[model samples]
Target: MKFLGNKSVASFLQVILTILLCSIIVGMLLQLLFSFWVKNSSNLNFPLQLNNSGLGEFARITTPFPVSYGFYIFFWTLVYTFQVMTAFIIFFAIRVFTFFKNNDPFSYKVVSSIKWIGVITIVMSSLQFLSEVVINIYFNHLDKLENGPIAYVRFNPGLSGIFFGLIILAIAQVFLEATKIKEEQSLTI
Candidate 1:
């Protein structure tokens, strides 16, 4: 509601935020579906006995198409979610910076909050990526036999770079806001 004070900026932020939230929700759902598929796959025998080449080949061949599809969906969802969230944070930092330029009294608090949120989001995203990498490595190692068309997809480094850049921008916004607040305090005195 507070954001609605500035009609244009508020509307823009609302639209972007809505898209980011929806993407995140979809990503989570896709991940859940993938997890279920992995859990229920009978071909992926427990202990993952890599010694038996025939069984390994059979395992790779027998992996359900749906499971692979689910993984693909989850991967893309994650990528989009991260990109959208990063964009949202950058948009917010820009808005806060604009407020600072206008000498708004609340700019400091807003920018600080945005920075903290960006930091938290970045940390959560990093953890999610790490978890995905570990899972991929485990599955790849278990699936030793190259039976069918092996789909090897790499995580987008550009997305990570964007996230890092957003974090830095957020930090800069916070510093700028703090300076604005200091200037305001001096003016008031």
Candidate 2:
């Protein structure tokens, strides 16, 4: 079936984003439960395995598994931040698409929503990076290193989302200008 127009695509996206948002909510809940379980579990020590096996070879093993409190806190913090910010971004995206489906694609509210999405994207990416730093710090602490040369910054830096957000900001700027031109044309008649 062919999509009628922009509305069709927007409506479709709205549905998808709604599903994703719901999933995020459920995921956050599950993670919380899991963290609680881990924290309260009696078996504080489990098998710790690290395998760097070659082709058709066996594996290796490491020390026992001991989940530190700092690690637990860091994990939960990262999960909560990433999940909530992601949900925020998707929620705003849904609003933007809803505007298109409602036949007001270039309305002020729509443009504003896009701008918000862009800002939120940038913020979320930064938070993701920060999360990595938190985990790295936790590891360094666990290793008993005062100032060891260690870093946990991911190489990619999650730029794709930031780039996409910047593009959306550009689109919002274009819409703002086009909206002005349309108003001027209407006034001439």
Candidate 3:
């Protein structure tokens, strides 16, 4: 049950991450193509949920409206950007696993990858929060039926994701200090 080295858990995880990375890329591309196809078809009416009034009311309320092409593209762009960032996080995680498998726990690459993961996670979380706000406002204006505040914007900016990102950053700092100590010890010996 070793943490590092060949044929260990790290190596197995690296392989799994590699596969996951490929799958995400492929799936995203396919989704983009399908989205375009769906857009071109005239028969399909895109359903827009006006509000989350209540559990029973929400399920029954749905309005089919023609969303502008520009808005549709913009929304998908935000979704795709988030997905790409997610893929990058996974890619960096794979790099960390690769280092571990090679028994290089204190390598600069490992520390850098971990730091990037934290930074990306924080950015991704914030971007998602902002995008949600923008989409809500846009939809509210689009919904002709609702006269006042059709979409209520929640003040709750997803703090949990940001907190998790900060924790990861702290872990990266610890890894950095460990790397420095390891280097100093090697020099002394």
For all candidates in order, the CA lDDT equals 0.57, 0.71, 0.82
Per-residue CA lDDT of model 2 for 1-189, tens digit only, reads: 323345497789899999999999998888787777766763432222233543444333333346577667776787798788889889988998887777766667777887887888888777766776765556557546533223232344677777887888898898888778777887899
Give me candidate 3's TM-score against the actual structure: 0.85
**Model 3 off-target regions past 4 Å?**
41-57, 60-62, 144-156
The prediction achieving the highest lDDT against the true structure is: 3
lDDT-better candidate, 1 vs 3:
3
TM-score rank, highest first? Answer: 3, 2, 1
Model 2 ranges with Cα > 4 A deviation: 1-7, 40-65, 144-156
Q: What RMSD does model 3 have? A: 3.6
- Which tens-of-lDDT digit does each residue in 1-189 have in candidate 1? 344444555556555665765676676678666754755653532232355575554223444422455555565666556655655665565565456444463655665656656675666567576756855674565356543334443454335744874866667576766778788998999
> How high is the lDDT of residue 103 in model 3?
96
lDDT of 3 by residue, 1-189 (tens): 998999899999999999999999998999887988766663423333444654433222334455688887887898799889989999999999999999998978899999999999999889878887887777667655545323443455777889899999999999999999999999999
* Candidate 3 clashes between residue pairs 3 or more apart in a chain or in different chains: none
Candidate that beats the other on TM-score, 1 or 2, i.e. the better one: 2
